[model samples]
Target: MQPDDVRRTDVSTSPPDVKRPTRRRALVAAAVAAAVLLPAGAAVGYAYTGEVPRGVTVLGVDLGGLDRAAAGEALRAELARRSADLAAPVTVRVEDRTARVDPSAVGLAVDVDATVAAAADARPGVFARLFGSPTVDPVVAVDQGRLDAALRAAVGDVGQPVVAPAITYDGTTPRPVYPESGRVLDPATAAGALRAGWPDAREVTVPLLDVHPATTTADVDRLLAELARPAVSGPVTVTTDRGDLPVPPAAIAKSLVFAADDSGRIEPRVDEKALRSALGTGLREVEVAPKDATVVLDGGKPKVVPGTDGQRLDTAALGRDLLAVLPRTADRRVAGTLTAARPAMTDEQAAALGIRERVSTFTTNFTGGLSAPRSNNIVTIARDVDGTIVQPGETFSLNGHTGERSYAQGYKDAPVIMDGKLVPGVGGGTSQFTTTLFNATYYAGLEDVEHKPHSYWFSRYPPVIESTIFYPNLDFKFRNDTPYGVLIDTSWTSDSITVSIWSTKIYDSVKTEWGPRRNITKPRVVHLEPGPSCIATNGIDGFTQDAWRIFRKDGKELKREKFSWRYDAEPRFVCGG
Candidate 1:
């Protein structure tokens, strides 16, 4: 082998005698050169070219700059200049109201400049550094963008402000604002507004009320006119018994007034006028009435009086008697009663009973007889005509038994006291009748339940046994003490009065047990001489006695007690002709 051949072999074996390009080596060489060249080129572009990425937008404003950072800074400055005036408070008007708010309070901010600076300071990795600059800043959008949008929307809708006018309570008339309380609304502005906005489902009405002067008759007339009648939608008239009178629905409504003022409250003013007109037009009316009592003889059998144009009522006489009784009639009803139903009596029967002889009687004035309070008349006749029966444990009331007496009944005036003076009045002597009956009842062993004393002492009657009565307040009462029923019979004569009892005989006989008249306190007596013009009178001493009687049945001891009798101690006046 020659030297050349040997050398070639050595070179082939000696790991590449001549240089060969490799994949890794080529890549490194190219990258180093590009790195050096790209920087230089970028430097040149930045110095001369104003080119920027196509999509580069800052704050929604498109721009061209040396790089993303520079563009961002420029955008921030522009935004700051545009929004500088919005940092302060802004005023908005709505109706009559005004409101002010700081723009910053509504999510507005001046931090854009600082945010841009931070973005400019951020750098990418080494590879991206070699290529191109990173995006200027992560798309900086307004913070709380949605919130700001909402605030802006609200501000856009703000309207003009409103001013309320002042109110006053004038003195025209102090009246309730809500006259119809039920349908009335609150007078407050807010409440009124709400109510006006939505009326109630039901029918509503408001009544107007005001006060007026009531001093003049004219005022009263006006009030009456106002109260005339109410215009009622329903039936218009009603009837009453005082003859046919008219009624209007409106009038009924007028009867009740709303809250009255100084003058008076008038209700349903319109309705009242309408009702009055309707009433004046003459509606048919039915007569309202009361029960009419008819007097009858013997179970309602009436006998007609012969004359007087069928006007059965004795008006003239009744009026005078009523006038006399009126004063005492206060709080009391005028009443009388027949003892019982009576069968008609023929003349023969009346004679047999001696009624004519028994009833013809009169009493003298107080000078010669009992005083006014102790006088009696009606009860006596009642007992005599028809006996009264009182049962065991029964109380007899004079007023309860008697009924009202008017011109319709058979009542005639006797005599009575008027203003403390004697006058002709009906039922004047009735108490005398009651007194006689009372004495008979006492003798019959009945209990004296209630009795009133005379205002003045009377010397002509039995001091211990006499009784008197007025209508309701003053009454004579007694109870039947006996086990059986007792009947009373009374009779009268020109000179004397008698009362008898008819009943089952409770005892064989009743006798008074007399006490000795001892320790007599003699009273002074006087006598006067007779004169031509005046009659002379002698006075006697008064006397009092205590006595008792025993009741026996078949000789058996039944009851025993004391009885008393008293005469006025002053004396009795005896007159002589």
Candidate 2:
């Protein structure tokens, strides 16, 4: 126990303490080795088992230590439960309205197999597995087309469309209807947000965007102030060589067309057709037509008359200039461009017409008891057709010259032959003028283009050779076939009308040959008149006749023209039977 004895004992005890620590170290090493080996053995066993590691979870569903098949079953069940929960309708707010949509209806689904596989893959390495497996969310699958359609349908219910600006015209002014802004839910963005956070969030707000109108109030105001109002403010005066054509404000307003341009700007345009129509009679009055030279017989010789040059207003150029000046407040007058027009026949052409002394003349005598109105009508028709000139190759229409013989042209009711009966009608005596004119043209060797014989053969007219005319429907037409200008000269007294053709003679002589009437039929007995308007008259027998016109030069037969007519029988009428 003293210093030497205490030192020897402490040495022995220290050696014992060192040996004890070595044994303790050996025990600690063995414990650490066992800890590593157990987990390694468990990992090896797990690898051989073909099963998911313990504590693995997918979307909060545990599938610990399960084989692939069992894991898949568990995953399917969990996915079904989760999907059903997510199938709850989520409320979507668009503007002030709300709509509910089931996430599954929009093709939202949980990819259970993929999610399970991902969770299985998240299992840590052998060392980390000793701690725990990771928890992973389920993979979500979405059908974009279905989701887009659903979102659009929902948006359509709540969206307010934008109103476009429009223009309306009053009698004198133009007014603008203003545009309005609108709100619409953005379908694509709203669908994306819903897909990302749906089910978890019970409510979602739809993204809204403003829709602006293409045309605004300012645009309408600009159009009215700059284009529409100025176009119709004042008259546009077009000064031509003839006279001034003042287009009134109302006419300009009617001609002005307002339309939108490619850039969507409203502008004014002049409608050429409308402007021409508005000009109408005014334009025709200002038009100066070229006058052709005429030929006349001067003492049995041909005489040439000179033609006059014509000045015509260029209407197209005037329209353009008028449009240019329409926007101006002052100096609104524009001079129209004049175009020169040459006549078809000149003085040389007139001399070449070959007009000379009278070629043929015919006179028709009417009964002296003809009413004053009938005599006046015959004289009036003769006067109207007196100075008519037919150029070579030109056809003359008697109805075209005389027009409709009615009260408007001072014609009076007179006796006329109509429908195989004599009746009192307007322009009754003009047929006498037609018969005289046809005979003169026939003897003059003119070509007959169109002519109609009277329905009933009249003794007063040449048998089967005379022509009759009605207003516009029926006409007596003949062509001036000779290379000459033929002048129609008409003269009439109280009971006789004469028509003479003055032109260069092409034939030596012309003669008419009449045949006896054949196939005659007896007239029918007349019935009583229906009213006082009916006139009693004696009937005539119906018959057929043939006639011919023979033209000869130097006594040799040149040509012979034959004509035939079949007249219907007339019935006798008793007025007071």
Candidate 3:
């Protein structure tokens, strides 16, 4: 390409807006395109096959007097050496934080073939080869979009995100979550800085931009005063059809929540479900209760109460009503409208349970140690569960009802079996009470949720069917699977304890058929010297047995289930101490 001489145009003759292109500038732009766009290996191959003018240098390597093959070989060796250096990670820095990212991972490459073709573009005439030395630009390939993403990950999220203002209710008090300013590293600028430093720079410091949150401290303070503080200032009265449902400040606090709007201003929202849960048993007094169809013991006879739907305060609209009155300082009251409510147990479901008679009655007589502390413990736990009511489909838990029996609760230490030996334990002999209750529930054909028999066989209780309980750990539980409500009644004397279960009888009777004992193992005899802890015992042999339960309704077999258990051999306690 021919060069154009520089000539300054006269301002008087030419228009200011009109600018002309130079011939030398155009040729230089075309030469750059030839070098940069040498994207094909065939072009590199063709360039290497050609003789280069002397005084040419690529990356400070003189190809000045080299042949076609020699020039290509030298260029490849130099590029390979640079590639090894590029294998090290490119260090990135943002303030004090520094990270090392792999060159290939960030889509950076030497592009050897393209660079080789580009280096072949440097040419000099005979006179210039003797006097002038020129340098060829290396083609460093970079994927801009990929580099931006890689740099963003290498530098941590630029900085922290802005914390928006919000409010939360902590019991009866209102609390505020304040907003804060943060910093951000612009992706495009960071990527440019990284590219300029990579494979050559020791480290690059990324520029940071300060950011401010949409919500300010003033906004949070305004919300706390206007909405949060007043919401839980005092109790709110909601008038129902029957009486007033008083919602305390604690409940009001639970219902109040804060959220940000489109303009980032904090706003209040009432949660109806949360409000109902916070209200708890208070709703039962003011709201008209729905009567479920159930059988109850009336005048010592089974009686059915027909199901009836009742009208209660409309919980769906309670939030709206509460929201209107929450911010008021005086007379924070709202009139709640009534809505129809349905019973969980309908009349048809109660009738199907067949709980119209005394289902099961059990009596167990306690001998030996009748006047001991064990008897007192038994009576104490028994009285706690007396007249207990088990609703339909409800699982009655003995441990849950009577709670942990301790000396504070009037329980005394007594001899109890633990680790195959008789040891003194609190709330002892309650296992007898457990056995009695288990028998009653078993005869009633109730659903037994959990039960565990004794480690050793005892003549006092039935085999493979008795239950033992230890305060909080071991428990006897039974579910009233029938629709009829179960009434647990207990009575205890000095020598006898009796448990009777009353419910509408679904089955005429539930009977257990015994199975012959097998795999009998004799007990090991051991003697303890005379001491206060010494207790004598005549241990029974261990055995495995299976018993079948026969359920009969209207004198016909309804269903049959099998029960299996393995009893460990009880050690003979020959106390000589």
- Output the number of the TM-score-best candidate: 2
lDDT (Cα, tens digit) per residue for candidate 2, span 1-577: 3999999988987887578889999999999999989978967666434467666777567776777678889878866677667778878777776777777787766666776676667656655555666566667666767765776676565667656555554754665667777765655667666755654578887767677766667877876676667766877788877778888777776667655443334455667777778777777656778998876555555567788998777766776777678777778898977788789888887777676688999998887544687787888788888868888889988888778888888788887776655678898788878888999999999998888888766778887778787788779999998888899888776678888898888999999898988899978877666674577767777899888999999879899999999988777766766
**Weakest lDDT window of 10 consecutive positions for candidate 3:** 1-10
Instruction: Order the numbered candidates by TM-score, best leading.
Output: 2, 3, 1
Write the residue-wise lDDT of candidate 3 on 221-311 in tens digits.
Answer: 8878877888888888888778888889888888777866544566677778888898999988876688787666677776667889987
Computed on alpha carbons, the lDDT of every model, listed in order, comes to: 0.42, 0.76, 0.78
Question: What ranges in model 1 sit over 4 Å off?
Answer: 1-392, 398-435, 451-475, 482-486, 522-537, 572-577
How many angstroms is residue 433 displaced in model 1 relative to the true structure, after the best TM-score fit?
3.9
lDDT of 1 at 526: 35
What is candidate 1's lDDT per residue for 254-309, written digit by digit as tens? Answer: 32223334233333222334333435434223211222221112332222222111
Weakest lDDT window of 10 consecutive positions for candidate 2: 259-268
Report the C-alpha displacement of residue 154, candidate 1, in angstroms.
63
RMSD of each: 32.2, 21.2, 15.4
After TM-score superposition, what is the CA distance of residue 148 in candidate 3 from its true location, in Å? 23
Q: By the TM-score metric, which is better: model 1 or model 2?
A: 2
- TM-score of candidate 1 on Cα atoms, chains taken together: 0.31
